[model samples]
Target: MKQQNNTKTALIYAVDLLAIRPYSTQQLITKLKRKEYAPEEIQEAINRLTARHYLDDTDLCQRQYQAYINEKHRSIKAIKYKLMEKGFSQSDIQNAQEETDIDEIDYEYTVCLRLLNSRYIPSKSDKLKCQGYLYRKGFNYSAIRLAIEDFFYNP
Candidate 1:
């Protein structure tokens, strides 16, 4: 039947995509829709893949959080926004953070301080510029203020 054929094709496409990189369920749905797959066929493919443990949003969420933290050094807000933009649900992002048990506030301060230490030169730069940079980087005002103070006063 035409329906069966579409389902098969969708499954194959989904699997191929997953082989290249992990995708959240919503992202995969969007991709399949973009490819013009029928809604029923797309849903069937998604169900099968999820049953096969090939489409796990939770695991992907956790891994992405770690990747953003370790590789990108993003602030908590930025990481959450990026993950949500990638189609992860807010609850999933929160659960991932809980699973990791990260003290993100402390981590944010540390990251802010590290960034300041790396880029700030007392002679060439000013506190206002550093504050603006950290703000642009998604750091909270409190973290920015503390990092600036530590960089200028403690050192």
Candidate 2:
């Protein structure tokens, strides 16, 4: 009876957290553990949530990736790391990236162009600085070079 009550309480806590935002299974497990829920209770709550389709890492990955693309304008590498940090499996992240149709080179080019247009333009003095900034933002050397060339030659 005590174990059952703990499971129920853990489930309630998990549900409340989900109401705010989706969580990967590992994330929820960690949160519940931090709340002092026993391993068995946390696992039980996770199983219940999964059975109800309420705890889906794949869906969480997809939603997060889309938000990063549309709202944060993050690069693929950055998005991947963020998802991993959120406790999503590599396979789930790969699937989400595939579903989002994120072309690495094109996306990087677009992000670099947007950044250069909005904030950083590469002049003779600022060219290396701009390249380093883009690199820090998860863009590759080739994409950064192309974007800089496009910005200067076309603009």
Who wins the lDDT comparison? 1
Per-residue lDDT of model 1, residues 1-96, tens digit only: 134434458889999999999999999999888888879989999999999999999999999998888864778889999999999999999998
- TM-score for each of the candidates: 0.88, 0.87
lDDT per residue (tens digit) for residues 10-104 in model 2: 88999999999888999999888878877887888999999999998898889888889886477778889999999999999999888987677
Q: How high is the lDDT of residue 114 in model 2?
A: 88
Off by over 4 Å in 1: 1-8
For model 2, the stretches where C-alpha displacement exceeds 4 angstroms are 1-8, 122-125
Error of 2 at 111 (Å): 0.6
Cα shift from native, residue 110, model 1 (Å): 1.5
Model 2 weakest 10-residue run by lDDT: 1-10
The count of residue-pair clashes in candidate 2 stands at: 0
lDDT of model 2, residue 153: 76
